[model samples]
Target: MDSLKKKEQTLKSSCTTSQFCFFCTMKEPDSPQRRAGLANCFKQMPLTDDQENVLVSSGLFHIAMAQPDDPEFPSLGIFECMASLIQKGVNDEMWLRRDQNIYIPYYAAHIIGSYTMNKVEFAEKAVESGVIPPLMELLRGNKMSWVEQRVAVRALGHLASYERTFEALSTYEEEVVRLAMDLASTCVDVVYDNFVGVKDTRRRAKYQCDLLTRGVGGFEMENCKAEEWTSQLQCWSLYLLNCFAYKERSLNLICEEGFLRNLCGMWGGLANHVSPAGVGLIRILCYSKYGRKKVAELNEVVESLCNLSRSSDDWQYMGIDCLLLLLKDTDTRYKVIDIAFFFLVDLVEIKDLGDRSNFGEAIIKVLLLDYHKQNKVKLINISSSKARKAVEDLWDWNVERRRKERAMSDEKLEERRVLVGLIKQQASRLYCLGEIEEATRKYSEALALCPLSLRKERMVLYSNRARCRLLLEDPSSAIRDSTRALCLSTPANSHRKSLWRRSQAYDMKGLAKESLMDCIMFIKYGCIKSDQDQTATKPRSGVKIPYYAARMISKQMDATWLFATARSRIKESDNQCGNDEGQYYREEIMMRKMMDNRGLSTIREEPLVVKEDINRRKVERARRISKRATSQIGLPHDVGVAEIQCGGPTKRDRYSKFSSSDFISF
Candidate 1:
């Protein structure tokens, strides 16, 4: 127990010393307590790379979580201390050579790579300062284990993703590509050697070979083929060749070099390994620039794919997508569609009626419209047995979906009812308090909860809310809601209220002429029903008086020509019967009295027929002028009269003074 106590005290003291050293050397004191606490904790624990990583990660987290609002945060200091530790550990020769300490440098590299603060610069500095040499050396070493290589390779890939490292590595592109290829090649060879003749290893080697061939142009399939190569390798070879053909589009490489022939050869040997995805890739390559020149070779490959697509029941859907992509160019569209149509016809006759019917529907929907529209194919002879079955199946599915939807809608309706009731209650309260804006908002919320199918009720709610919006001086929203209300309303349901609300909204928006028309309609349709009800309730003796009174009221408020005539008559009557003229008639002698009484008569004068004829002539002239102004005369709408006629003489013969030659000169 005493020996353990002494060892613990020594560990605690060493950690304290390290903390003090970091603070002194790094000159950052922000997370000194956290650092000290972690160090002391480590003293009581076994020192493993994971435990050290926990401390390192804790430090990084503290730095990352520091906020700009906290004046006393030492995030920069923490990052500096962590960076220093990583640099020192990676650079230390003793640490790098120690077998047990290998994990330290590896973890350090990981930390450097993942650090959020200027990570790219830090990684570059580490690499440029030769800190990554040992790791790279281990990666290239013959005695290096597979696990170590995997780690190194992953780390390098991560580093390469960074822009700075990518730019730096671009200068040595050939070297980098060669190194990556060699590592992948070595991995492939090792897998093959270890497994002897195992199919799985051959498969793994094929995958590695594919990766190696990514940017390496000259590394072809012949160099990688071995006696142990399985169908998997052939698939990979086909993939690599397709990729190369895709990049260069070299007809020579595609045909003369036997790229498509080799790819097609693999179809028989590796049909199972070469799936629809692989086939699709080959299809794309064959339609590429280089592949287009080698039409015969391209056709052979496409024919092989089409055959596989037709024969393989497993991946036929993928084959359809490949056919669609290949047919995107106009040149191949008709031909590809023809082939696809044949396949679809075959699908219609398939033994599994359900799948056949479903596929038939999909093919018709995806292809028929395009084929018929572009190629003028009638599809008159197409099989209807599968199509009819598909439609029935689709109808059944729709019925089920609609049934579920109705049930969901019922639940939503119940929820909406409760929400609308709450909104209405709130709106009533707000309305009482003279908060019209808030009241209108609540009313709008209530209306929005109403189902669209209930047009009559929704129109009422929308019209009412629109009025409230208009009162709140929000004419745009008012107009929108009012318009919606009118659209929802039916002729049988009476849209007068909606029209009235819209008229109010339009009036508020400075559209008085439009508003007047709507208001007149509202008074004519909406008020007539109420007046009739009132007349029905009234005694028979009072009916005539009320009817006459309603007619007078209608004349005053209506926007028709009758109202204009009434207004003109009122203006004439007021002008003739002055107060002086009325009294003068009473006091005058016989002849003068007769003249005065004629002008100031109590009875209203009917408009003279001659005056009416003159007014009619003026209205007709105005209409003619308006029509002429609006009619097109080979000029744009913005062109002025001067621009249109260029100072032409009037039709009243103003040009009679001038000869045709003088007019032309002018």
Candidate 2:
């Protein structure tokens, strides 16, 4: 242990020249090494009276100088060390010194404020022994400098948070309250007098009011007649009243009689002094139930705020935020909305250039939702339509601006491509969820973000979006996108597919003949004309394209007209020839026509056509048997058969004939 003490001493002496301490090197003295060293040193020699005095004075000096880098730096930890030293009776003489500057004791008391848990006993002993009295005396002294007063008041507030200290102070509650009130009153006076000639008197007054409110509120005055007493003080009084009225206890007291009315009037007069956009005063007025009764006066004040809001275009944003508070009360909601509407519309129309679009839209959405809930249908519809048009216009403007921007920036083009891809994915999910309108919006956004360089991708997006729009019953937009997709097609696999989609859009819009023309083109270019053998009896691979393209063309097919024309075309070809080859050709043509009519263009000719033909013949044979059986059952031939007819009795009919006899015999 002695060796450890010597080693500690060596570390400390080495630290002295290094302009730091051994404890400072460890970052935290609570660390095992630092704590062990401190304990060992304490047990080894203990601090002599002179050494303790030196350490305390050095700690105090460093704290005063705000030198946290010093080895004996005065921090909360250092204060804990001092309290430990005092508790151990290391140096009672220095601890009890009166002329050592009240800062030392005041700081020590302030430090004690943090000791609410186990340090109550230590605090009680210190107060009982008169260590706290000197600090109190310094706090109440008129000659204390501002810095000293701030420190003392903060320390008192801290100590007041403790249960025992606060309870003990409760015995002298009246006296403490009177002292605090007096100090607050004097502090307000000093601030007014000192700041009277200042250029920024308003700001100075606010700060002074804040300080006084904090000081008085910290005392927790029970019988303090703050309201009646504060009525005569103009700027500072109104400020403090506003502050206190927000406090629960003070609000309970101030709401009686005509106190809230008079307070509201004073706040209005001081409102100009407060930052116009700053709602601190407005918020305080709106706090209590009593303030609700003075809606007219509040409205007047809010109306006057429009001037401040109009002072600068930027002020309009802040103005809207302030107006939102007034509208929060159901009674005043409509009045505030009406007053704010004109300003909002003007902001949107005139300042639609920058961030105003978002702000305007936000405010309009709130008003519309509220008005709609109140069943004001006309107002709701008007606002909704107006907002929708505004949003659409803003969207177009943004798209045009971004288009221009991308033209100037290659980096922006890449970013736009990535964004478009993400939007397309989200659009697909939304479409799957049956949110057609939202999906259409997302698809439009994707198209706007897509660069012209990605023409193939852009074409696919347009085609998909056209499908969504058509599902939404927006045929005009669907046709527009489809046309754009066809125009923008490139050599990618989806180009001819876009033509088929455009054909579907045309058919949906009642342009069937135009759609048929596109289908023929799709067949010529999109489909492969295999020359191997048109009359082959085996299945073969047909042209491969996207499924959506196939579906689209199938949807556009004029089933009655196309079927008749295909059958006639096949018969005419067969009539122009005379052999088994012509018959086979006719069969192949009929099969191709069948697959095309069913929108199954992927089927090959050789085996699949033969299998499908055999299935078709079996189906025809079954129909004939069903017709013959229905005739034999004496049912009208015009009536469709309802059961399978294999020229045998049904199980239900046969069982009905023998059920009783068979059961008895068994």
Candidate 3:
């Protein structure tokens, strides 16, 4: 200790006497001189993984963290170095140790993104220098880690943002789209397993009190920053897809099955709740007729939009924007109204959103005109006047509660509030232990002791009891509790748990329409992000809209036909209950108008192709098969058959005479 202290005491004197300081070199701003120094630092080559990673990861991390606004690094060949480094790190397993080399890919891609963020010229140069392929590798998981994918998507987002390089990005569109979809869908759980939990404390402990703080922060700062990065990683992946979606580059891949449902549940909005996360990508997807049709076909997406439309978040207009686009064209309007109508009718009288003054009225007008006469959502007396008052109160958040005050003072109310929280916690533990009866009785006792002014607490108690009722096979009691909980909540039916419980109860009673309505309402409530929780990065209050709730809605939507009742009415009039009567309801001429108006005539619906397109492809394949059969058997090319002619030798017999390799396409 004495020897080390003497060495440290003279360290500055040694530097001064030697006429050079390494600390000064590291402190200098990004310049050609500084960058040149870094390049030389790696020239003494063939260092061990431990030694080399110190230089590589440290240099890349700083450069990535302090990225200049003026594009200093990319102009100095730093971008090319980072690109080369990512390629090297991905290929070499020897140096890619868990503690060291794993950071190379992350920092390398972050450097590219930080540089290309402000300038289009830099992104253009990056594409010219071959950055997309290596970045795409990180996205595709050459290492199979979400850590690399986080920065990889960020870099590609910058690359795709430029007009000069989007063509290059679209070159690998299908794979990139598929990989990004999987990442967006599963990255959260992937990160939670590997980086979170109690057993992984050592893995996370290495990063504590480090880079997250540029200096002055404390109290679990490492975990908080990791969480922020995870959120950004998820949102950035969506941002990359948003670039493709907004440009309408790969609508076929963006609107693929199950992704829309995944997109709806991605509630990790922007860091400060500045923008709702997946809702923006979905809104961009709705710009085209093809996207609109595909988005409308899914009940989950529409109901989520219906829910998000009521949000007090900054992006509230996006939800209304998507629903309006879906309802704009008459061809896609009929069947979607039943899912959107009741959910949206609550917003009909809300003239609150500043972006669009008359959106409420406009929504009703669009539904009526495009919904047609026989198959329409009648807007007359939609929500009750009491529900309208709740919605009005929702907008005017400053308005005080109108309930008659109890005799208790503020001191007694505070004591009661604390007591309710304790009781609820006890109930939660009992519920987790499967003590449904005890939990229900505890929640009821809490409800009795709670003050009337404590609406939020009382509502939670009622919702909890509703869950107990559902578990006890008491559907009627569940319905009453859920309804009371709904009434207690502001903005009418925004309580997700109660709505889900009520939907299940209604399903038990065979009330299909009511169950489906509550199902949509349930999703809509989950989509409502608030500006209040932005700083804390907290999730929504209730449990997520249940999976069984979503399944119930999808099942109900399948049985729903907008004109089923009207078709039966027609059969009764004509006494002709034939299948042909089903096709005569309305001749939709808007498909051509939709194609021309949206300019999507060039984009084919490969994922959800029309029936005629399917039949045409089938016929083309059939002709090719017949032509092959003609060549094999001496039959004429004029005959067309899906299966070979009976007179010709069977496929097995012909293949037996010739080598199997002779007909590889077959």
* Candidate with maximal lDDT: 3
| Tens-place lDDT digits, model 1, residues 1-666 | 233234334443555544423223233355676555544433322223222333333333334345312322222233233334344444565643443333333333333334423456544654564434444544554433333344344445444556566544345444444444344334434433432223233443332343233224222221223211322333333333344444443335445534444344332111132343345445655456444435332556555455434332234444544554454544454444544444443332122221443443454355434333234344333345454344344344334544654666667877766677678778655544445567677877886565534556666667667655655557667666665565454432136665555565555555443454454445445554555677786742211111211222223223221112223333344335442342233222221221232221121112211211111122234324323544533222212221112112222222234333212110
lDDT of 3 by residue, 296-323 (tens): 8898889778755643334657887888
Residue pair clashes in candidate 2: 537-606, 538-606, 538-607, 539-606, 539-607, 540-604, 540-605
Rank by TM-score (best first): 3, 2, 1
Task: Please give the lDDT score for candidate 2.
Answer: 0.42
RMSD (CA, Å), candidate 2 to true, equals 33.9
TM-score of each: 0.27, 0.28, 0.52
Judge candidate 3 at residue 112 and give its lDDT. 83
Stretches off by above 4 angstroms in model 2 are 1-189, 192-249, 252-320, 334-357, 366-666
The lowest-lDDT stretch of 10 consecutive residues in candidate 2 is 607-616
Clashes of each: 0, 7, 1
What's the lDDT for residue 599 in model 1? Answer: 25
Which regions of candidate 3 are displaced past 4 Å? 1-60, 198-200, 203-223, 269-272, 370-666
Candidate 2 structure quality by residue, lDDT tens digits, 1-666: 233235445554554433224334444546666655444433332243322233333334334345323332221244444344333332244444433222233334434433322345544543444334444554565443332344344444444545566555445444444444344434433422343212233544332332334224321120011221222233333333343434422444434334433322332111122322123434554554455335324555565444323222223344455555555566555555555544343332122323444454554455444443235453442334555454444444444554676566778777888899899889766554445568778988987777756766877788777666555556556655655565454321124554455465555566543454455445545554332255267665444433333333334333312122223433344334342343343333433443454343433322111111111123244345444544455332211221122111232332344332211110
Full candidate order by lDDT, most accurate first:
3, 2, 1
TM-score of structure candidate 2: 0.28
lDDT for model 1 comes to: 0.41
Candidate 1's displacement at residue 186, Å, is 6.2
